[model samples]
Target: MTKRIQHWLAMLVTTFMLTLSVSAVASNETSANSDNERLGESVVRQEITGFAGADYWRMVKDGQEGYTTSKSPEHGVLISVPGQTWYILKEKWMSPLGALAIFGSLAMVALAYVVVGPLKLSKPKTGRKIKRWSRFDRALHWSMAFTFLTLAFSGLTLVYGKHFIKPVVPTEVWGWIIYAAKQYHNYMGPIFGILLVAVLVKWWRKSLFTMVDIKWFMKMGGMVGKHKGTHPSAGFSNGGEKAIFWLLIFFGIAITISGLVLDFPIFDQTRRDMELSNLLHMFSALILICGFIFHIYIGLFGMEAALDGMITGEVDETWAKEHHDLWYNEVKDLPENQPGYDAAQEADKKGSASQNNA
Candidate 1:
C-alpha cells in the first residue's frame, strides 16, 4: 500500500510542474504580441502622415533647406523661421505704431492751428517784392513736393490702406487700387531718390547749422510760447528748416537704399535680406511722414505768406525782413532790390497794361 501512494504523489507533482511552465510561456507570448502590434501601428502612422516626426520639424525650424530644382536664394527652404519673426514685428508692432504716429501728427497740427493761429507779420507789408527764390529753385521745390506727396500717398496706401480704403471699396476695385499703388510706389521711388540728391546738393550750404540757429531754436523759431510773433533773426534757413533738411537727407538715403533693395530683387537678395530691408524702409518712411506733416502745416497754415515764395518765387520785403532778417539784409541791396530796378519793372508793367487796354 505505501508503494502505490508514493507513485500517485509523483504523478501529481509532475502534472503541477507542466501546468506552471505552460502558463509562463503563454504570458510571455501575449506580451511579445502586444509589443509587435505597437511597432506596426507606429510604422503605419508614419506612412499615412508623411512626416518624419519631431526631428524633421526641428530641422525645418532651424531653417534647414532641402533639395529642390529651383536655384533661387532660399527656394529650397520649406519654412523661413526668421520670416515669421519679421512678420510678427511688422504686423503686430510697426503697423499700429505707424498709424498712431501719422494721425497724432495731424491732431497736433490741428491743435496748433486752434491755439496759435498763423504766424502773422509784426509790421505791415512794404509793397516791395524781394526775390526769395529763383525760378529754378521754385521749379525744383514744386517737383520735389509733387514726388514726395505721390510717394507718401502710395506708401501709406500700401501700409494702411486696408484700414481706411479697403473696407469702403468693392473687392475688385480694392484689388486694382492696391495694384496701382504698388506700381506707382515702385516707379516713383527712383525719381524721388534723384530729387533727394538734387536737393542735398542745392541746399547743403544754406542748411548748415550756425550759432544764430541755436538762439532761434531756444526761442522756438519765435513762433511759440513767449516768443510768439518775435520774428527771430535767421539766415537763409532757420534752425527748424535746417533740422528738416538734414532729416530728409539722412532718412531719404535710408529710404532710397532700402527701396532699391526691394524694387530690384535681382541682386541675389535672400529672403532675410528682403525682410530686413522692408522693416527699415517702413520705419524710415514713418519718421519722414511725421516730420513732413509739420512742414506742410508750416507752409499752408502755420505761417502767413509762407507759401508765397514757393508759388511766385518772390516774397514781400516786409515778409523777408521779419522772417529771414539776416538773409534779407544781405540781399536787400542787390541790383534787383534797388529803387531804379523797381521803377524800371513798374514802368514795363504799366506799358504792358496800356498795350492790352489799347
Candidate 2:
C-alpha cells in the first residue's frame, strides 16, 4: 500500500514537470518569433541623393551592419531597418472619423433619392425660375470639387499606401509612389486656394444670415415626408441648404489658406506654427470631408432631380414643380420663357399682358 501511494505521487510529479516544460518552450518560441520579425542589425546612418523626401537611410547589407565592436557588449543594440514610416492600417475600414465621412455621407446620398419632403402630398408645388447656379459659380464649384477629389485620393494614399501596398510593391516602387503623391499634393494646393476664394466671393451675398432665414429655420424649410406638405420657400436659396453652404465656405477658406502656408516654405513658419497648420489642415480637412458627405447626399439624393441643373443648367419640369414650387413660380414670371403654358411661361405671359393692359 505504501509503495502504491509512492508510485501515484511520482506519476503526479512527472505530469507537473512536463506541463511546466511545455509552457516554457512555448514562451521561448513566442519570444524568438518576435525577434525574428525585427531586422537584427546595427544601423549606420548614411545620406543619399536622388531620394526626394528621404533625409537619411540606415545601411544594411544581407540584413547585418558590417561594423565591428571590440568592447564586450553589456547593453543590447536597437536593430532597425532603413525605412521609418507611418502607414494607414489596411483593415476592414479606416478610423471612426474616416468611416463617418465615407459611410454617413454615402447613406445620406442613397436616402436623397428615396424621399424629399413628406410621405403624402396635399398639393404639388411650382415656382418661378430662380437662377440655380451662375457660370462663375459652376466653374468655382467644379474647380474645388476636382481639387477636393484629388486631395481625397492623395490623402488616402498617404494613409493606406504603406500597409497593404508596401507588401505587394517593392520598396523602390513604393518610394516613388509616395514621392508622386507628395508632389501632386503640393502642386494642386494653389489651384484649390483660388477656388476657395471664388467660393467665398460668389456666394457671400446670398449666404449671409437674415431675419427671414431665421424664420426659415424656425419651420425647418417646410420639409415633410412623402405624405405631408412642403412649407413656403424663398426665391433662390433655402435656409438649410444655404447654412451648409456657409459652413463649407467658412471651413473651405480656413483650410485652403492654412494649406498655402504649409504647401511650401514661403511663410517663415515657426515650428509651432507649422505644427498648428498641420493639425488644422488634417482636422479641418477631415471635418470638411464629413460635411461634404452630407452635401453630396443633398446635392444628389436630398433633393429630387437636383443634379440636372448643374449639368444642362436646368432641372426637370416635374422636379422643379415638386421641390421648389415658390421659386419656380417667381422665375416663370420672367420675360424669356414667359409666354408658354407650363407654370413659368404662363406667369410670364400674364405679367406681360398685365403690363400691356396698364
Candidate 3:
C-alpha cells in the first residue's frame, strides 16, 4: 500500500513540472511580443521623422553631387531619376521590340520566299555577258556590306547576349564574348557610317524615284507570275533596288548620328541626351536590320541572275533585257568588249549574212 501511494505521488509531480514548463514558454512569448511592439513603435517613429531630415534621401532624389575619380559626369550621381526611367524603358520596352523587329523581318522574308519562290527568268541564259557593276562600284559595295554586317552582328551580341546566350554559355566565356562584341561594335560603327554616306552619294542619281519606278511597283516589277512578260522601265537600278537604297540612306544617317552620340561620351551629352540617343540608335538599327533582311533576300536568292550582276560585275544580255530594258537600250550600241556592244554586233552580223544569202 505504501509503494502504490509513492508511485501516484511521483506521477502527479511529473505532470505539475510539465505544466510549469508550458507556462514558462507562454510567458517568454508574451515578453518577446511586448519587446517587438516597443521596437516597432521606435522604428515607425524614426521612419515618420526621417523624411523631414535634409540628409535622409535629398541627395539621392535630387541627384546631388558626390565624390568619384571618374571623369564621366554620371559617375558621381547618387541617384538619377532620368537614368532610372531610361533603364526601365531600355530593358522593358526597347530590347523586346528590337528583337521582334529583327526576327519578325526574317520570318516575313522566309514566308515571302516560301509563298512566291524565286523570280525565274523567262529567257534562257545567253553565252554573252554585259558589265553591270564596275570594279570601283563592286569594291565600295563589298566594303559597305562587310562593315554593316560586322556592326549588325556585334550590336546584336551586345543587346541580346545576356538574355539569350548567358544561360547556354559559361559566365567567363560569355563575358569575353560580350567584351569582344562591344569593341567590334564601337569601332566598326564609324566606318559603317562613313561608307554608307559615300555609297549613298555615289549611287544617288541611279536610285532616284521616277514615274517609271511607280509603274514598276504597280506591276510588281515583273516579279509576279501574271506580269512576267512586262519589262517595267528601269535604269541601272530597278524600283525595288531604289527602295533598298533609300532605306539604307535614311536609317544609316539616324543610326550613325545616334551611335556617335553614344560612342564618344567626351561630348558631355546630358543624361537625357544620352538616353534619347540610345533610344534613337536602337529604333533606327531595328529598321535598318529589317530592310537589310529584304535586301539580302532579293540580292541573294529571291531573283535569278540578279546576284551575277554584283558578283562578276556582269550579267547575261537576255537577263539585262528582261529585267532592265531601258538600261539595255541606252548602252546596247557601245564598242566591242563593252557591255551590250558584242551582243548587238552579233545580231547585226547574223542578220546581214542571212540577207546576203537570200
Candidate 4:
C-alpha cells in the first residue's frame, strides 16, 4: 500500500510542474506578440509623416529654390533665412537702443536747462540789428526743417506706433493711421534726400573745421560751469554749429542712400541688400534724431536770441558782438551792418508782404 501511494504522489507532482512551464511559455509569447505589433505601428507612422515633413522644412530653411511659376526674385524660395536674422537684429537690439538714445538726449537737455539755465548775453541789446542770413537762406532753412520734422514723425510712428497707438485706438483707426504713415514715409523720403543735398551744397564751406572752432569747443561755448557768461570769441559758425552741420551731412547722406535703396526696389535688389539698407537707415536716422534734439534745444531755449538770425535774417548788434565777436569785427564795416540797415530791409519786406496779401 505505501509503495502504490508513493507512485501516485510522484505522478501528480510531475504533471503539476509541466502545467506551470506551459503557462509561463504562453504568457511570454503573448507579451512578445504585443511588443512586435507596437514596433510595426511605429515604423508605419514614421514612414507616413516623420522624414518627409522634416526634410521639407530643412530645405526651406536652407533657402533652396524650388520650381515656381512666378519670375520674381526669390519667388521660388519659400522661406528667407536672412530675413529672420534681420528681424531679430532690428526688433531685439536696434529698437531698444534707438529708443534709449532719443530719450536720453531729451533727458540731458532737460537737466541742463534746470541746472545751467539759458546762456544770456553779458551786455544789453544795442537795438541795432545786423543782417546775417539772407532771405533765400532763411527760406531754404525753414523748408528743410518742415520736411525733416515730418519725415521723423512718420518714421517713428511706423517703428513704435504699434506699441503705443495700436492698443489705444480701434482696429479700423489703427489701420488707417499706419497706412497713412507708411505712405507719407515712402513719398517724402526722396524729398528729404533732395533737401539734404541742397543743404550740403549751401553750407559745406561754412561748416569746415578751423582753429577758432577748436578754442570755442574747449570753452564749451562759454555756457557751462566756470565759463558761464564768458562770451568766448568765435567765427561766423562756431564749433558747436560746425559739428552739427557735419553730423547732418554725413548721416543725412547715409540715410538718403539707404532710403533710396529701400524705396525703389526695381533694380533687382537681393534680400541681403534690402536687409543691409534697413539696418543702415535705422542707425543713421537714430543718430541724427538724437543730435537734432540738442540742436533744437539750443535754438529754442539754451541761448538768448540764438533763433533770431534764422527767423528774421538778422540778429541784434549785442548778440553778434558777444557770441561771434570775430565775425562781428569782420563785418562791422559792411553796409548791411550799419545802424539803419534793418529799418530799410523791414520797409522793403513790408511792401512785398502787402503786395502778396493783395
Candidate 5:
C-alpha cells in the first residue's frame, strides 16, 4: 500500500511539471509575436553589387513599379536597369516605316510615267556649246552607274523579297534565290566599294561644297521645276547632287566596313557587337537608297535634259544653255565643245539639238 501511494505521487508531480513547461513555451511564442509588431520587422538589409553585374540584396527595401528600391533599416538601396518594348508602329491601318518608304518609292516611280513624256524637247537651241565629259569619262561613269542600278534592284529584292515577292516565287526557288541574292549582294559589296572609291577620286574636286553651296542649299538649288521657274543653273553638278555624292561616299565606306566585319568575322566580336553592326549596316543602306532613288529620278524623268549627261555624256544644246549655263560657258571655251566638231561632244550636241528643237 505504501509503495503504490509513493508511485502515484511521483506520477502526479511529473505531469504538473510537463504542463508548466509547455505553457511557458506558448507564452514565450506569443511574446515574440508582440515584440515583432513593435520592432517593425528587423529588415536588416544586406546588399551585394559587382562590376558588370546585377545588384543583389537580402531584405531590400523596394518601391513598386516605376518607383523601386527605397532605403530603410530593413531594406537597402536598389538600382534599376532599363527595359525595352516591342511595339509595332501602325500606318494607314498600321504599317512599318520601312513599308512606307517602299510604297512611296513605288508610287514615285509610277508617277514618273505620267510626269515625264517621251524624250522630247520643248525649245531647241542652235547655238554652239561646251564639252563636259569625254568618252573615257563616260565609260567609267556608266560602268559604275549600271553596276549601282543592278545592285539596287537585286538588293531591294533581297531586302523585301520574302514579304513582297515570295507570293510570286515558288517557296523552294524563292529560298534559293534569296540565298543567292544575299551571296551576290555581299560579293558585289566590295565591288561597289571599289567603284565608290573611284567615283570619289574622280569627282572630289568638282564635288567640294563651297560657300556658294550655301546659297544653293538655301535656294534648294533653285530646282523648282514642278512650280514656276526652271531648275537652278548649275556648273558640273548641283548642290543637291553634291550632297548625294558625299553621302554615298560616307555611307559606301560605312556599308563596306560593316559588311566586312560581318562577312569575315575578322574581330573576336561578341554577338551583341555583331548585332549592332547588322543594324548599322541596314540603317546606312536605307539612307543611301532613299537618296539614290531621288538621284535616279533627277537623272531620268525628273529633269528634261539631265539624262544624257550619264548615258551619252552630253545634253541637248538648249538644255545645257538653260540648266547648266555656267558649265556651258566653260565648255564653250573648250575647242572640243565646237559643234560639227565630229567628236562625241559634237555628236551629243546634234542629238540634243534634235530633241530641243522639237
Candidate 6:
C-alpha cells in the first residue's frame, strides 16, 4: 500500500510542473502577438493621416466646404481670407490709430488753452441784447449737440472699453456697461443722422465762403497774438464756422451712411461691404471727433459769451460787435439801445447809394 501511494504522488507532481511550463510559453506568445498588432495599427494610421503641418492647414484654408445645416452659401466656407485680413486691420491698426487721434486732439486743445488763454472781449458788455439765434435755431443746435455727444460716448465705449475699462471694473458690471453702450449707440445713430441733415440745411446759407472769409482766415479770426484787439469783420458765420460746417457735412454724411450699412444687414450687403463700411465709419467718426473737441471747447470756455448766443437765442450788442461786425450791423437796431441806433442810419445811407448806382 505504501509503494502505490508514492507512485501516485510522483505522477501528480510531474503533471503539475508540465502544466506551469506550458502556460508560461503561451503567455509570452500572446504578448508578442499583441505588440505586433499594435505596431501594425500605428503604421496604418500614419499612412492615412499624411503630414501634420502646412499641408493640413492648407487644405482647410483653400476654400474648403464645411458641413452645415444652413442653406446660405457663405455658411459653408471654412475660412475667409478677406475676413481674416479685416480682423487684423481692425485689431492691429484701426483701434490704435483711433485712440491716438482722439487723445492727440485733446492734448492739442489743452496746450492751446494753456498757452493762448481765452479769447476775451476787448469792450465792456452794454447790458443790452440783440437776437442772435431764433428759437428754432437754438432747438436744432442743442438737439444735434446732445445727440452727437451721446453717439460719441457710446461709440467710444464700444471701441476702447475692452482695453481700458474691463480691467478696472468688475466683470459683471463691465459686461452690463458694454451691453448698454451698444444699445444706446445703435438706437441713437439714426436720430443723429436726421438732426445732422437738418443742421446742414438750416445753416447752409450762412456758412457759405466769401471773400471776407479770406481776410478772417488771414487774421485767424482775431484769436492770435497782436491780433487779439483786432476784431475782424464777419458775417453770420466766420471762416472758421464755415470750415466746421463743411467738416460736419462731409464726415457726418459718411458716418451716417456707414452706420446705416452696419445697423441694417437686411440689404443683403456682403461681408466685404460691411467690413469696408465699418472702417469708413470708425475713421470718419474719429476725424469728426477731433472737430468736435474744438467745437466744444470754443462753445463752452474758449470764447466768452459764445454759449450765450446758442443758449438764449441772443447776445449782447457789444458781444455781437466784437465777434461778428457785419451781422451786428444788420441787427444792431433790434436791441434795447435802439433809441440812438446810428447803425440803421448808416445802413440806410449805404442802401440809398447802392440803389442810386443800380
Point to the candidate with the largest lDDT.
1
Candidate 2: TM-score?
Answer: 0.59
Per-model TM values vs. the true structure = 0.81, 0.59, 0.76, 0.80, 0.63, 0.77
Task: Tell me the tens digit of each residue's lDDT in model 2 across 1-358.
Answer: 9999999999999999999999999999999987765533211111132342142223332223343563323112234222121112213323446656766776765665564532232444344333466666676777788899888677667766776578899899999998998889888877777877777778778676667667677766666543234555554566776888877777777788778778765455644455556556766777778788767665665555567677655555445555556566767566543433375666788999999999
Candidate 3, residues 1-358, lDDT tens digits: the string is 9999999999999999999999999999999999999999988877856744557457657877677898876778868888888998888998998898888999988987998788888889976777788888899999998998888888888889888898999999998999999998988899998898899889999999999899999998877678865778787788988998998999899999999999998777878888999988988888888888989998898888888978888888888888888888787665543644666678899899999999
Across residues 228-279, which tens digit of lDDT does each residue of candidate 4 receive?
8887788888999999999988999999999999999999898889999999
lDDT at position 3, candidate 5 = 100
- Backbone atom clashes (below 3 Å) for every candidate: 0, 28, 0, 0, 11, 0
Q: lDDT tens digits, residues 37-100, model 5? A: 7565433221223322242232232321223365322122232211011111112212246557
Q: By descending lDDT, how would the candidates be arranged? A: 1, 4, 6, 3, 5, 2
Candidate 3: lDDT over CA atoms?
0.86
- In model 2, state the lDDT of residue 313: 58
Off by over 4 Å in 4: 1-53, 69-71, 342-358
Range of the 10 consecutive residues with the lowest summed lDDT in candidate 1 = 47-56
**What TM-score would candidate 3 get against the native?**
0.76
* Full-model lDDT for every candidate: 0.92, 0.64, 0.86, 0.91, 0.67, 0.88
- With a 3 Å backbone cut-off (N, CA, C), the pairs that clash in candidate 4 are none
Candidates arranged by TM-score, highest first: 1, 4, 6, 3, 5, 2
Question: Can you tell me which runs of candidate 2 are displaced by over 4 Å?
Answer: 1-101, 107-131, 163-173, 222-232, 339-358
Judging by TM-score, tell me the better candidate of 1 and 5.
Answer: 1
Instruction: Tell me how candidate 2 scores on lDDT.
Output: 0.64
- Stretches off by above 4 angstroms in model 6 are 1-59, 62-73, 334-358
Clashing pairs for predicted structure model 1, backbone only: none
Q: Residues 28-136, candidate 6, lDDT per residue (tens digit)?
A: 8999999999988988766656544556557668766667898765677778778888988888999998899899999988987998877888888987778788889
